[model samples]
Target chain A: MDLFAERGYAEVTVAEIAERAGLTKRTFFNHFTDKREVLFAGAKDFEDSVAKHLAEADDDLEPIEAALLALTEAGLALAQYGDYARARQELIASSTELRERNLIKMASLAVSIAEALVRRGVPPGRASLTAQAAVAVFTDAYAAWTERGATADFWNLMQQSLADLRRAVDAAPSRPSGA
Target chain B: MDLFAERGYAEVTVAEIAERAGLTKRTFFNHFTDKREVLFAGAKDFEDSVAKHLAEADDDLEPIEAALLALTEAGLALAQYGDYARARQELIASSTELRERNLIKMASLAVSIAEALVRRGVPPGRASLTAQAAVAVFTDAYAAWTERGATADFWNLMQQSLADLRRAVDAAPSRPSGA
Candidate 1:
């Protein structure tokens, strides 16, 4: 990350990244398919954790509630990496390639959550809608948490963001024509 | 699009695209930066139209309502090109590069709508949340419309998707611990 931050993401080579960490290119390739994967190393684990959490959620929970609970639980695990998260976001914001990768990661995460919701007996359409909205809440809360550095309460931010989302949706006109 | 559909997006070159349209490579570059841009040619115009619609929306509309109204109005204009839209979506889904570009375009649209909402007196946080939710609604509605082919009513789909979003959000637990 420091190498990419200093020399720009595109300019930094896999060999250099490997060398900086006192490893060979072959060893680096063993762990990551490409340089971009370095920035998204934990994405699979994060998705898995969220899925596991959702699967274990109580059967009585609403689709949206189950999805949010899973996401919040999974997201809170990242609280220890607040500074790294902020720096990673800045790096991503600076590079189109990284930003695109980040977006794809988020989209995949939403899809996984939606599928998990479906497994919990939620209908497909409602599961998809709930998962998408829950992911939005997570994204906003994560952004706020990273912006505030390591000490911010991610749990509080997630709750506040969810409240804001509910209020915004509630404010929408019941009939489109009425707007 | 035909060339991309038949030969794959990466395999199709600017020269071939221009030749297929009976134009020279220079002419193709004059209109688009690359082959990928050919698939996204009207993105700028679509964003501009959404912004224009939002700017002209009634002041009484809530932030989410105004954003949705703008997106739906702009989206309806593409009802004429439903077949084309479906083909474009298929090509995008098949190509990682195209999917990334599509995601970036949607993200930019959300940011633009959020800025428009902020200009209309909504707080920044609320504007951001509203815009993201509105975009999610637009995305699902657009997908359903295209899935049902050219005859589907884009406006009605947008309305249905928005209602689904509202119902899903309403289903979320009011307190984090309630679940």
Candidate 2:
């Protein structure tokens, strides 16, 4: 976020980033294809862990439960990166390019969730819808948990958000047609 | 979309866009502050229609009903631009910068919904949650409706998606303790 605020994403060179990190240019490339990647660095690991956890979860659990379980488990992993997460969030907020990259990463992960379901025998259309909804729940939970500060555990907050999603979707009666 | 794909957002130059539209650059600037606005050209009017429709909507309607009603009504406004909408989607997908711009627009609209509800006397947190949920429903339904060739009307698909969300949420016979 500092680099962006100081010089803008378009203007900052990868070499400058490497020099600042006290790392060689080759080392930087070895870690990330470009500076923009620092924003999305750990997403794949999150996705993989979520998928792995869900695969081992009980089959009787509904897709939403299964998804939330995965999200909670992923949140546990991110617990060590609280400050890093905040900084990354700021970086995404700082640039339009980064935000788009973040969305695409999210959309792609949602697709992965859907595909995982399909491989496990979920209907394709249902898979897509369920996956999207799960992603929605996870996203809402993550956002709520991220900014909740020191009083909350990320995993616990995610669980609450999942519960909130349940109440919002189920307990609230569907709106009448006119409204 | 054509203009953007051909010349890129920054390189397109607003003056050239004005000429293409047979208007002066001054008129273009009067309409938008920058090139990104052109890509989201329809968003403002769409939001206006939604806000207006939502404001006049029956209070008794459930949240899903309220969301679908607004989406369906807005979808009609966008129907004529089906091809254009698809093109815009493509452009946004192809460019991270444009996608982030789109997310900010979405975030703004979500906040607008929350504010509108707060004015209507709903509690702040509930209003925000409901607004975010509404956006999520529209996003999933719109993606389904558009990606599948617009076979179903926008509102109908939204209703289906809402049902799908309900089922997804309720499918879990029981949530875990942490959940």
Which digits, one per residue and each the tens of the lDDT, describe model 2 over residues A51-158? 888787677777766766776776677877887777667667777667767776777788888877776677777777677667766777677666665247655665
Worst 10 contiguous positions by lDDT, candidate 1 chain A? A170-179
Chain A alone, TM-score for each of the models? 0.89, 0.80
User: What's the CA error at residue A75 for candidate 2, in Å?
Assistant: 1.8
TM-score of each: 0.91, 0.79
What digit string (tens of lDDT, one per residue) describes model 2 on residues B144-169? Answer: 76777766666667777777766756
Which pairs in model 1 have colliding backbones?
none
Error of 2 at B104 (Å): 4.0
Best by DockQ: 1
lDDT of 1 by residue, A1-179 (tens): 88987989999999999999999999999999877889999999999999999999988888877887888888888877878888998899899878888998888898999899888877889888888898989988888877776577766787789889988877735465622
Provide the TM-score, chain A, model 2: 0.80
